[model samples]
Target chain A: MIKAEGLTKRFDDNLAVDGLTLNVERGEVFAFLGPNGAGKTTTVRLLAALIAPTDGRAWVNGYQIGEDNINVRRSVGILTEAPGLYERLDAVQNLTLFAKLCEVDDVAGQVEKYLRLLGLWERRAEPVGGFSKGMKQKLAIARALLHEPPLLFLDEPTAALDPEAARTVRDFIGEIKEAGRTIFLCTHNLDEADRLADRIGVIKQKLIQVDSPANLRHSLYGRRVVIHLASVTEPVRTAVSSLPFVEEMQQMDNALVISLDNPEEQNPILVERIVAAGGAIQFVNELRHSLEDIYFALIEEEDRETQA
Target chain B: MNGAKIGAIVEKEIADARKNRMIILSMALIPTLLVAMVLGTTFVMLNVESVDEASLDEDELSMIPAELSGLNPSHALLILLNDQFMFYFLLIPMMLPVYIAAYSIIGEKETKSLEPLLATPVSTSELLVAKSLAATIPAVVLTWLSFIVLIIGGYLIMPEPVFLAMIRPVWIVSMVLLSPLLALLSVFSGVIISSRMNDPRAAQQVTGIFVVPIIALSLVVLAGKIFLSVWMVFLAATIALAVDCVVLYFAVKLFQRETILTRWT
Candidate 1:
C-alpha cells in the first residue's frame, strides 16, 4: 500500500531523514522503531505528504506523495504524536469536524460510531481539554478512522497511555489489521511494536533496518543452546566448552550459557558431556534474543560504525 | 481547493466561535461601546447649558485646533467627536483581523492542531482564504453597523444642515467599502505575522501597530491640518488592498508544513 525509494529530508545543515526506503503491503502492520530524534516522525510526515521531500519519491495507495498529495491524503488517515486535537471542542465535535472535512456522507453517524467504538461515547460531550492523555489519544484515533481510509499513519499512538488504555489502543490497531487496513506506526515502544508489528523497521540517522522480529532476533545472536544447571562449577563450565560444536561458554549464575554455530545437532553431545563431567543438568533449551535485545544490539553496532 | 471543504472549515470555525460565548459577547460588546460613546458625547455636547470655563484649562484648550476655536461649544464638540469616531472606527477594521487571525493560526499551534489540519486533503489556498474571510467578514459587518449607529446619533444631535450633508456617498463608501478592504489587509497581515512569530500576543501587538497611521490621520483631521479628499482615501484603500495581496502571497509561500513541523516555535 506504500512504497518509497531513497527518501530523504534535509533542514538547512541537518539531515532529518536520509536515503531511507520502505514498503508496506496491504493489511500489514509496519512498526517504525527509533529513538526520539531518529527521523521516524519526519518519515511519517514525508509519507503523509505534509512536507515535500528533498529527494526521491514515495507512493501511497498508488498516489505519488508530493505530486498526487490530495489523492494520497484522501486515501490515508494520520494520527500525529501530540494528538493535535482542538482542546476547546468536545470529542464528538472534533471527530465530526474531521469527518466532514474528509467528506464523509453522514458525519454525525460516523462520529457516533467511532466515538462508541473507542469507548469515548460517555465523554464525547466534555471538552478535550478536560480529557486525560489516553482519552485524547483515543479521540485522535477516532478522528483518523472516521472516513475509514484504507491506510493509517500513527505516531506514538500509545505513548502515554496506562497499561489498560495502551492495550485498548493496541487491540484496536490489531482489529484494523484484521480488517485488512494498512498501518504505518512510528513508535519508540519496543514491546508495543513487538506485539503489533508484522515487520519492524529500526531507523537511525535516516537509514532503516527492516526485518521481521524473529529474523532480527536470529540474526543478532545466531543460534545458541542454553543449559540450566543446578550448579555452575569450574569443571562443569570447562566440560561444556570442550564439546566440539561449543564455540563459547559462560556461567550465568546457576545457568550454563553456551553459544554454538548449530545447536540442533550439538545439543545432545553438550548435554552428555556435561553429565559425564558430573554436572547435574536441570534443563536444556535454545536461546533466542527478544526484540529489545536485537534493537539495542543494532543501535550499538550503528554507534560503533559511526565512531570508527 | 473544493468549496465543500472550505465550507466545512468555515462552518466548524463559526460553531467554535459560537460556543465560546465570551468571544461572541466581546465582539458584540465592542461595537455597542462604540455606539454608546459616540451618542453619549454628542448628547452631552448638544444639551449642556453652560460651559465650565475651568474645565477648559490652557492645556486642554490648546489641544483643540485653532480653526475650530470660533465655533460654539456644540459645533466644536461635534468636530472633536467626529475625529474620535473616525479614530475609534479605524480600530474596528483591526479588531477581528488581529483577534481572529492570531487565534486561528497561533491558537492552532498552541493546541498542536495545526499539523493535523494541514495534513488533511484541504488545499493551502482554501485554508488561507477561509480563515481570511472568517476574520474579515465579521469585522466589516461590525464596522458598518457601528457607522450606521453613529450616523443616527449624529442626525439626532447635530443641526439639520450638518446632519444631511454628513451622509454623503463618499462617506458611506469609505465606511462600507474601504473598511472591509482594510480589514482584509489587517487579517492577512496578522495571519502572516502569527505564522512566523508563533507568539499570538506578539503577533497581535505587531499587527496592531498598523493602526497607528490611521490614528494619526484622525488626529490630523481633528487638528484641521488636513482634510482627506475622497480621491486620497480611495488611493489609500487601493494601496492597502494591493498590500493585502502581496502579504497573502508570502503567507502562502512561508506556510510550508515542513517549516512548521521542524521549527520548535
Candidate 2:
C-alpha cells in the first residue's frame, strides 16, 4: 500500500532522511526502527505527504505523494507521536471534530465504535485535559481511524508512556493490526516492533536493512541448533564434528551448539552420530535470538561498514 | 473549498473561545471599555456650552464638515470627536480579533495539533480561512453590538443634532462596512504574523500595531487636520480590503506545511 524510491529530505545542509527506498505490502505491519534523530518522523511526513520529499517521491494507496497530496492524505490514517488532543474539548468533541473534517458519513457511529473498542466509551464525556496520557493516546488513535482508511502510519505511539500505558498502546496497536489495515509503524520500542511487525526496516538516516524478525536473525547468524547431552564425551564432539552435514560446532559444557543448513532435515543425522558415539542424549532445540540482540548487531555492523 | 470543513473549524474555534478565560475576558473588556469611553464623551458633549468663534481659530474650526459647520462651535467639535471616536470602533474589530487570531495558528503549534489537523485533507486555504473567520466573527459582532450601545447611549445624553452626527453615512459605513473589512485585515495580519512567529505574545504584540494606524487617523481627525467624507470612507474601505487580500496571500504562502512541520519548535 505504500512505496517509495530514493526518498530523501535535506533541511538545508543537514540531511534528515537520506535516500530511503521501501515498499510495504497490503495488510502488512511494517515497523520502522531507528534511534532519535534517525529521520523516522521525517520519513513518515514524506510518505504521508505532510511534507514534500526533497529529491525523491512516494505513492500511498495508489496516489503519488506531493503530486496527489490531498488524495494521498485522504487515503491514509496517521497517528502522530503526540496525541495532539484539544485538551479543553471533551473526548467525544475531539473525535467529532476530526470526523467532520475527514468527511465521514457516520461520524457518531464511527466515533462510538473506536471509543468503545479502545475502552474509552465511559470517559467520552470528560474533557481530554483530564484524561491520562494513555487515554489521550487511544483517543488520538481513534481520531486517526475515524474514517477507516486502508493504511495507517503510527509514529512513536508508545514513546513516553509508562510500561503499563505503553503496553496498553501496544495492545491497542495489536488490535489495529488484526483489523486488516496496512500499518507502517515507527517505534523506538524494539519489543513492540518485534511482536507487531510483519516485516521490519532499520534506518539511521539511511535504509540499512528490511526483513522479517526471524529472517533478519537467520541472515545475520545462520541457523544453529543446541543439542543437550547428559555428559560431554570427547568422542561425542569428534563424532558430531565428523558429520558431513554439520556446518560448524562448539561444545559448551554438556551441550553441542551446532550450526545446520537445514536443522529439520539434518538434525536427526547429527543426533544419531552423537548417540552412536556413546553420548547420552537429552533434547534438541533451535537457538533463539532476541530482536534487540539482532538490532544492535545489525546497527553496529552497518555503522562500522559505513565508517570503513 | 469545503464549507462543511470550514464550518466545523469555525464552530470549534468559537466553542473554544467561549470556554477560554482569555477570550471571555477580552470579550468583556473590549465592549465595556468602549461603552465607557463613548458614554463618557457623550456626557461631556451634553454639558459643554457652545464654543464661540473668538476662542478657537477658523483654520482649526474649518476641519468640521460643511454639513456640521452650521451647528454651534461646540456641536461641531462634538461632531469631530464623535467621528474620531467612530475611528475607535474601527479599532475595536481590528484590535479584538488579533489576540485570538494570533493564538489560532501559534496555539496549534503549542498543542502540537497542527500536524494531525494538516494530516487530514483540509487544504491550506481552508485552514487559514477557518482560522480567520473564527477570530473575525466574534470581533465584528462585538463591534456591531457595541456600536448599538454607543448610538443608544449617545442619543439619550447628547443633543439631537450631535446625536445625529453619530449615525451619519460616514460613521455607518465605517462601522458596518469598513470595520468588518478591518477586522478581517486584522485577522489575516494576525495569521500571517503567527505563521512566521514562534511566540504568540510576540505575534500579538506585533499585531497590536494594527491599532496604531487607526489611532493615528483618529488623532488627525481630533487635531482638526482632516474630515472623513463619504468618499474618504469608501477609499479607506477599498484600501483595507486590498490590504486584507495581500496579507491573506502572504499568510497562505508563509504557512507552508513544510515550514510549519519543521519549524514548530
Candidate 3:
C-alpha cells in the first residue's frame, strides 16, 4: 500500500532520509527499524504527507504525497510518537472531536466501538489526564482507527512506556495486524519488531535492507545447528569436519556448533556418520539469532563500508 | 475549508475551554471583576460629585459643545465620563482574547498535538479560522455581557439622558461592531505569535503588546484630544476589519506545515 522511489528528505544541511526506495504490500506488518535521528520518524512523516519530501516521490494508499496531500491524509491513519491528547478533555469528548474531523458516519457508534475494544469503555467519561500511559496510548490507537483507514502509520507507538504499557501497545498492534490492515511501524525496539513484523526494513537514513525476518537471518548467518554429543573426540571432529555439507564446526566441550546451509536435509546423514565415528547424539536444535544481533551487525557493516 | 470541520474545532475548544482554568480566568473572572469594579467605582464618583458639588468646576461645564447644549449640565458631564469609560470596555474584548489565543496555539506545540490534527483532512485556513473563531466567541460574549451591566448600572444611577448616552450610536457601534473586530484582531495576532513561540507565557507577553496601543488610545480619548463621532467609529471598525485581513494573511503564511513539523520544537 506504500511505494517510494528515491525518497529523500533534507533539512537545510542534514539529510534525514536518503534515497529510500521501498514497497509495502497490502495487509503486511512492515516495521521500520532505525535508531534515534535515523529517519524513522522522518520517513513516517514523509509517507503520511505530514511533511513534504525534499526530492523524489511516494504514493500512500495510491495517493501521491505532495500532489494529493488531503487525499493522502484521508487514506491513512497516523499514531504519532507522542500521545498528544487534550488532557483536560474526557475520553469520549476527545474521540468525538477526531471522529467529526474524520467525518465518520456513525461518530458515536465508532467512538464507542474503539473505546470498548481497547477496554477503555469504563473510563470513557473521565478526563484522559487521569489515565495511565498505557490507557492514553490505547486511546491514541483508538483515535488512529476511528475512521478505519486502510494504511496505519505508527511512529514509535510504545516509546518511553513501562514494560507493561509497552506490552499492551504491542498487543494492540498485533490485534490491528489480525484485522488485515497495512501497518507501517517505525520503532527502535528490535524485540517488538522481531515479534510483530512480517517484514522489517533496517534503515540508516537509507534503505539498507528490506526482507522478511527469516530471510534476513538466513542470509546474514546461514543455518547453524547445535548437536549435543556425549563427548567430543578427534575422530568425531574429523568425521563432522570432513563432510562436504558442513561449512564450519566449533568444538564446545560436548556440543558441536556446526554451520551448514541445509541442516535439515544434511542432519540425518551427518548423524549416521557421527554414529559410525562412535559419538552419542543427545539433542539437536537450530541456533537462533535475535533481531538485535542482525541489526547491529548490519549497522556496523554499513558504517565500515561508509568509512572505507 | 470545510465548515463542519471548522465547527468541530470550535466545538472542541468550547468544551475544552469550559474546563480550562486559564480560559475561565480570562473569559469569566477578569470580566466579572472588571464589570463590578467599573460600576462600583462609577457610583462612588457620582456620590462624591453630589456631595462635593462646590469643589467641582462648574466653569468646565461650559466646555460641553453647543451641539450638546440641550443636555443638562451634570448629565452632559456624565455623558463625557461614560464615553471615556466606554473606551475601556474595548479592553474587555481586546484583553480576553490575548490570553485565549496565546494559550490555544502554543499549548498545542508544548503538548505536541498539532501533528495528528494536521494529519487530518483539515486545511491550514480551516484550522486557523476555527481557532480564531473559538477564541473570539468568549471575548465577544463577555464584552457584550459587561456592556449590558455597564448600561443597566448607568440607567439605575443616572438621569435618563445620561443613561441614553450609554447607548449612543458611536458607543453601540464600537461595542457591537468594533469590539468583535477588535477581538478578532487580538486572536489572529495571538495565533501568529503563539504558534511561533514555545512558551505560552512568552506568547502571551508578546501578544500583550496589542493592549499597549489600546490603552494609549484610551488615554488619548480620556484627554479629549479627539471627539469620537459615529463616522469615526465606523472608520475605526473598517480599519480594524482590514487589519484583521492582513494579520490573517500573515498568520497563514507564517504557519507553514513543514516549518511547524520540522523546525518548531
Candidate 4:
C-alpha cells in the first residue's frame, strides 16, 4: 500500500530523513521505531504529503507523494503526535469538522459512530480542552478514522495512555489491520511495535533499517537454549560443554542455560546426554531475542559506525 | 478551492471563535466602549461651554468654523462632534480586524491545532481564505454597526439639519467598505507574521505594528491635512486589496506543514 525509494529530507544543512527505502503492504501494521529526533515524525509527514521530500519518491495507495499529494491525502488518515485538536470544540464537533473536510456523506452519523467506537460517546459534548491526555488521544484517533480511509498514519497514538487505555488503542489498531487497512505507525514503544507490527523499521539520523522483527532478532543474536535441570553439577556442565553442538553453558541456582550452535539439530541429542548423565530435566526451551534487544543493538551499532 | 471544503473550514472557525467567549466579548465590548467614550466626551464638552457669551473671542468662534453659522448651541456641538470625533472613533474599529485575524492564526498555533488542520484534505488556499473571510466579515459588520450608532448618538445629542446631511453615503462607504479592505490587509499580514514566528507574543506584538499606519491615516484625515475623497478611498481600498492578495499568496507558499512540524520550538 506504501512504497518509498531513497526518501531523504534535508533542512538547510541537516538531513532529517536519510535515503530510506521501505514498503508496507495492505492490511499490514508497520511500526517505525526510533528515538527522539530519529526522523520518524519527518517520515510520517513526508508520507502524508505535508511536506515535499528533498530526494527520492513515495507512493501511497498508488498516488505519488508530491505529485498526487491531494489524492494521497484524501486516501489517508493521519493522527499527529500532539493530538492536534481544537480544545474549544467537543469530541463530536472535532470529528464532524474533519468528516466535512474529508467530504464524507452523513458527517454527523459518522462522527457519532466513531465517537461511540472510541468509547468517547459519554463525553462527546464536553469541550476537549477538559479531557485527559488519553481521552484526547482517543478523539484524535476517531478523527483520523472518521472518513474510513484505507491508509492510516499514526504517530505515538498511544504514547501517554494508561495501560488499559493503551490496550484499547492497540486493540483498535488491530481492528484496523483486520479490516484490511494499511497502517504506518511511528512510535518509541518497543512493546507496542512488538505487539502490533508485522515488520519494524528502526531509524537513526537519516538512515532506516527495515526488517521483520523476527529476522532482526535473529540477526542481532543467534538462537540459544534454556534447560531447567533438577540439579546442576560440575560433571553435567563439563559434559554439556564437550558436546560439539554446545558452545557455552552457565549454571544458575538449579538450572542450566546453554547456548547452542543449532538448537533444532542439537537440543534432542543434548537432552539424551543430560539423561544419560543421570540428570533429570523438568523443562527445556529456546530463547528468542526480542525487538527491544535488536533495536538497541542496531542503534548502538549505528552510533559506533558514526564514531568510527 | 472547492466551495464545500471552504464552507466547512469557515463553519469550524466560526464555531471555535464563538466558543472562545472571552475573545468574542472583548471584541464586542472594546468597540462599544470606544464609541461611548467618543460620545461621552462630546456631550461633556458641549455642556461645558462658557456661560458669558461676551467673553468668547473671535479666534474661538473661528475654531467653530463657518459651518456652524446660524446654528443653535446644539447644532454647533453636533458639527464639532462629526468634525473632531468621527475619525478617531473609526480608528478603533479598523484596529479590531488586525487583532482578530492575527489572533486567529497565532492563537491556533499557540494551542497547537494548526498542524492537524494542515494535515486535513482541505487545500491550503481554502484554509487561508476561510480564516481571512471569517476575520474580515465580522470586522466589516461591526464597523458599520458602530458607525450607525455613532450617527444616532450625534443626532440625539444635537439635533441639526446639517448633521443629517453630514451622514453621507461616502462616509459610510469609507468606514464599512474601505476599512474592511484595510483590515484584510492587516489580517493577511498578521497571519504571515504569526506563522513565521514561534513566540505568540512576538507575533502579536509585531503584527500589532500594522495599526501604526491606521493611526497615522486617522490623524491625517482628522487633522484636515488630507480630505478623504471617494476616489482616494477607492484607490486606498484597491491598493489594500491588492496587497492582501499578495500577502495571502505568500502565506500559502510559506505554509509548509512539514516545515511547521519540524521547526516547532
| Model number with the top DockQ | 3
For model 3, residues A145-253, the per-residue Cα lDDT tens digits are 9999999999888988999999988998998999999999998898999999999999998989999998999999998999999998889999999999899999888
What lDDT, from 0 to 1, does candidate 1 have? Answer: 0.81
DockQ of each: 0.64, 0.77, 0.84, 0.71
lDDT of each: 0.81, 0.87, 0.86, 0.78
lDDT of 4 by residue, A202-248 (tens): 89855547878877776667677888888887777777889977777
Model 2 alpha-carbon drift over 4 Å, by segment: A275-283, B44-67
Candidate 3 residue spans exceeding 4 A from truth: B49-73
Indicate which candidate wins on TM-score. 3
Local accuracy of candidate 1 as per-residue lDDT tens digits, A1-308: 99999999988888888898888999999999988889998899989998899999899999999899989988999999888898878887788778877889999999999888888999888989899887888889988999899999999999888998888888999898889999999888888899889999998855647988877877777777778888887888788777767777777889977888777778888888888888899988878677888888888888888889
Give per-residue CA lDDT, model 4, range B132-240, as digits (tens).
8877777777877887787888778744553563576547667866677776776677677776775545665776665676667755644434545578767877877
Residue A110 error, candidate 3, Å: 0.5
In order, the B-chain TM-scores come to 0.84, 0.92, 0.90, 0.80
DockQ rank, highest first?
3, 2, 4, 1
* Share of true Cα-Cα contacts across chains kept by each model: 0.80, 0.79, 0.82, 0.79
For model 1, the stretches where C-alpha displacement exceeds 4 angstroms are A229-254, A258-285, B19-26, B50-80, B152-159
Candidate 2 lDDT over A1-308, as tens digits, reads 98899999999999999999999999999999988899999999998899988898788999999899999998989999999888888889899989999999998999999999999999998889999988988899999999999999999999888889889989888888888999999998888899999999999999899999989989988899998999989898888888888889888988889988889889888887888999898989999888998889988988899889
State the lDDT at A77 in candidate 3: 93
Q: Count clashing pairs, candidate 1.
A: 0
Interface RMSD over true interface Cα atoms for each candidate: 1.3, 0.7, 0.8, 1.4
Single-chain TM-score of chain A, each candidate: 0.89, 0.96, 0.97, 0.93
Q: By lDDT, is 1 or 3 better?
A: 3
